[model samples]
Structures are given as structure tokens and as C-alpha cells.
Target: MRRYGPAVLLLLTGAAVLRISLFGDLYLRYVQAGLRPYLIVSGCALVLLAVVSAIISRRPYDDGCQGHRHGPGVAWLLTLPALALLFFPPPALGSYSAEREAAARAAQGVGTFPALPKAKVLDLTLAEFGSRAIYDSGRSLKGRTVRLTGFVTRDDDGTWYVTRLLISCCAADASTSKVEIRGVEAPPTDTWVAVTGTWHPEGRLGTDEAWPAVLDAGDVRTVPEPANPYEKR
Candidate 1:
């Protein structure tokens, strides 16, 4: 059993990966959608390696008669996470993660963004609205009723924002984008919602003061969390 620890770990981990990536959108909770293929390949490889390792270990190897080695007794404990991956995959990052992120905009300087579409109400990601609100010299979000969807997060003062994580590749590298929502009762933290509102400018564009954009919410409706929780930057 001790000799099989690594093989067991690999097998459990690979099956977990395949369960998340090959069968469904569960991988979206942790990585960008474009990365699904890579994850699938990696899972398949791990499973194959585990099978090969187990087969090779079963082959007879001659050793001059002696007592058995310890065979890394403690190493078996490492399989706990692999087992967890199989049964209890972690939830996507939520209000706790959002609350810890600082309220600073990226260093993108103020500039004119291209005009928005002809639609009456624009559907925008938190990242898009936050960026436009903070740095767009044109005030692109001005006068446009927009809808944003994200889980709720709050500050110590009870100010709640529609918050979402933006990832470059995976959850480990995710950053937060949020918009302070006003004129509506605060929802419980981490409750997903669609917020329809107009931008409420807070400060001068491109300045630190204008960060973490504000929205004057006209309507707030609880919604199911989306399939892909993180926005890929």
C-alpha cells in the first residue's frame, strides 16, 4: 500500500481534473475557458502516468533478503487534497476574496474609448464598467443605463459593490473589479445579482479618487451565478 501512494494520488487527481474539465464547465470556476483543452490533456496524462506507475511497481524486483523499508509512511497523507478534489472541489472565489482586494484601478492612463453600441441599455462586465468609469476621458458610461452582473461584496462601512474576479489565466492570478451600488438595499454578501443602473461619477477621471466605480442602482435582482465566474483579461 505504501508503494502505491503516489499512484493513488495521481489517479485521484487525474480523475478529479477530468471530472471538472472533460465532463462539464466546473473548470470555469478556476481557469479561463480557453484553457479547458490544456486541462483535459493534463488530466489524461496524469491518469496514464498513474496506471503505468502502478503496473511497473507490480513487476517483481529482486532484493537480497531484508526487512521492508518505511516507504514514506507520512507521504500517504498528501492524498487528502486529491481525495478532496474528487469529492469536494472548492467553490469559486467570492466576497472574501473581493473584500481583500484593494480599491485601485489599473495604471491605464485616461483616454477616449470608442463609442458604445446603439443599444438603449448596454450589458457590460464589471471590468468594462470599472475601467470606463475610472479612466475614460470621454465618460463613456455617462447617460447610458447599463446592466452588470456579479456577486455582492462589501466594505467595513456596509457599502456593497457588484464584484467580479478578472483572471489572466487562473484563479491564483485573479484580480478584483467592482462597482459601488447605491440607491438600493444591500444584498447578503456573495449573492449573485444583476444590477441595472447608470454610472455615478465619483471623482476626476484617471485619478485614484475615481477608482472602484459607483452605480446608482435602479433595480437589483438575484440571479444564479454564471457558468464562467471570472472574466479573462
Candidate 2:
């Protein structure tokens, strides 16, 4: 076990770096709910464990193991949690969260969305589309490539949403973001999936008048959730 310590540390370090790099922006956007403190605690524990292992490895083993393995072993064990983080990860924000947090879309004052320019390709994130729909009818999102990641939250009715949560460092800071995914193969609720489709707005008046909802799916697939599931973009 000691011999494998360095390998373990290496893996954990990689995971921590990955989380920081990929989710940093998303974390900043929604750093509420006391999530940051948990990160501080966990990070300190890992640093302390790594340091202690280094110290122990330097001390000669009275048992005469022939090499310094204890230090590395401790380092490896310290990494287990972080590696698990990269795998069996937390589910992103879904329908369960939609009602809990103020709707990301609703927050935008009632107005119509901007019509997407014809023949122009605009790329948007799930939050962008959802928020736009809430603020205006759906004008901002008309006719654009929207890329979103989330667990499927479906009602017995045909309506479904593609959603993900933005976490500051942990679950507490999680903020729900989602888009209406109409007209397509609906996966099971809570299943992680990716959708590449065009936005559609329904209704012809009021805030709905400005932006109209439209739906066009180019591709849909069940994909593994990224280590950092939130959309920084």
C-alpha cells in the first residue's frame, strides 16, 4: 500500500486541478449555500495528510522494509476521496431544484426575447436559453445552436427540461439552470444527457411576443457528466 502512495497522490492532484480549471467560473457565479467551507475543510485535510506522509516516509522503518514506502502509501490513501469525486459524482441540479431556487429564467423581467438573426449561428448554454425564455418570450434564443447538459426531469406530461446546477465548490452553493427541451426522445428522469438543438418559443403576445419558442433537435445522446457539470459559459 505504501508503494502505491505516490500514484494515489498524483491521481488526486489531477482531479483537484481538473475541478478547479473546469468549474472555476461556474463556482464563482453561484457560490452560496455554505459550500465553500466544505471545500476548505476537505482541502486542508488532504494537504495535511500529504505532508504527514512525506514526513513519515523520511523516517527509517525500524521493521526494515528495505525502502521508503509508508510515505507514498499515505499519500495514495489521501487521494482516494478526490479520485472518487471524479467518478461517482453528485447529480447536477434538476427539476427537484427548479422550485427551490428562484427560477433562473423567471428572474429576468417579463419581456420578449430577441429574434436570432437569420443565417447566423449563435451558440448558447442551457442557462442562457432558459433565462432568456423567462425574461422574454424566447426571442433571444430563436434559431441558434444551444448546447446544454443536465439530468432529464420529465413530468408525466410530455414537458421536459434539460438541467444542470452550478456549484461553488460543493452542493450547498448549487444553483439550478435549465432549458425547455420539447419535441424529442425524452430520456428517463435524472439521467445525464446532452442536447444539441435549436430553440423555439411559443405564443404570439406579451413577453412571449418578443421571443417565440422553437424546437429543432440536431442530435441527442446520453453522455457522461463532466467532472464539473455546471456551465461556466
Candidate 3:
């Protein structure tokens, strides 16, 4: 048991990474899709290491560990996180996280953005809506109907906003963007919803330095959380 202990630990760690990255949405909570290939390769490498260690352990006299008789007792600590990840994957960033981070906005006087895509109802992420509303000199959103999906958040003054987090690399670097919703009661906090609305230029324009842009919603409906929760840059 002692000789094979390190192998068992590596096996558990590798399995946990692969399980979250391939078999479930847990990996989406930590990293973007581009990192999936590296994760899979790392997991495969760890599993291969476990197999090699186990094979060497069975040999009576092996030079792999310089014939050390002691097991990797402290190394068992590495398996704790793997066990936790397997049993209790963390939830995606939502209202609570949105509340904690400063609202992300496009820099005032930034470069021009292309005209809004033509559609009866254009679908947009909250970050895109914010950038166009706050930085686009052309006021591209002046007369367009757009749809946004995000978890619900409420302001201190009782206004509700549809919010999503933007992640450049991982959850640690995430920042939030939101659009205030008018004409509908705020949904329960953290409830994912698709809001179809037209932009209302009542708030600070040409910048979100003062407040988030407002959306005069025509329809609001609850929806399941998307498979990929964070907006990637």
C-alpha cells in the first residue's frame, strides 16, 4: 500500500481534472474553452505518471525512487483538493460576484465601434451593449432592439440590472457589466433571464463613469444558465 500510495494520489488528481473539464461544466467556472486542450493533456500526463509509478512499485528492486522505502505521506495532501473538486464543484459567478466587482465599462472616448448588426432583434452580451452604449460615437444603439441574457442583480435604490461577468483569463480576473432593466419587476437575485429591450439613453451617455446604461425591456423571461457563463474578450 505504501509503495503504490503516490500512484493512487496522482490517479485521483488526474481523474478529477478530466472529470470537470470534459464531463461537466465545472471547468467553465474557472477557465475559458481555449484552455480545455491543455487541461486534457495535463490530465492524461498525470494518469500516465500514475501508471508508470504503479508499474515501478511492483518491482522488488527499482531505481526509480533510488530504492527508497518510505512512502509519500505528505504528498497525500494534493489529493484533498481533487476529492473536493470531484464532490463539490463550485458554482459559476453570478449576482454575488457581480455585486462584489466594480462594473466594467468601455473607456470614454475610445476608438469607434462598427455599426450595430442588422437584425429584427439583435442578440448581444452585456459587455457588448455597454461598450456600444458608452463608447460608440455614432450612438449605434439609438433605435435598435437587442436581447441580453444574464443573472439578475439589484441596486441599493431597488433598481434591477441584468449582469454578466467578463473574464480575460479566469474567474480571478473577472469584471462585470450590467444593463439596468426598466418596465419589469426585478427577478430573484441570481436568476438567469433573457431580456429583450431597446436602449434608453436616459443615464450617462458616452460613458458609464456615472451609471450603467438602461434597457427599456419589452419582454423578460427566465432561462437556464448558459453552458459557458462568462463573456470572453
Candidate 1 lDDT over 1-233, as tens digits, reads 66677789899999999999999889999999999999999999999999998997676555731223245577888889988888898999998887777766556888999999989889999989988998888988889999999999888898899999999989999888889999999899999999999999998888878887999999999999989999877
Which ten-residue region of model 2 has the weakest summed lDDT?
205-214
Worst 10 residues of 3 by lDDT: 202-211
Ranking by lDDT: 1, 3, 2
Please give the lDDT score for candidate 1: 0.89
Question: Considering only N, C-alpha and C atoms within 3 Å, which residue pairs clash in candidate 1?
Answer: none
TM-score of each: 0.94, 0.51, 0.86
lDDT scores in order? 0.89, 0.58, 0.84
lDDT of 2 at 70: 43
Number of the top candidate by lDDT?
Answer: 1
Candidate with more favorable, higher lDDT: 1 or 2: 1
Per residue, candidate 2 scores C-alpha lDDT tens digits across 9-68 of 844655564464354533332344345455555655665666666666666667667555
Give residue 6's lDDT in candidate 2 (0 to 100).
Answer: 57
Error of 3 at 19 (Å): 1.2
Model 2 off-target regions past 4 Å?
Answer: 1-107, 110-122, 136-138, 203-214
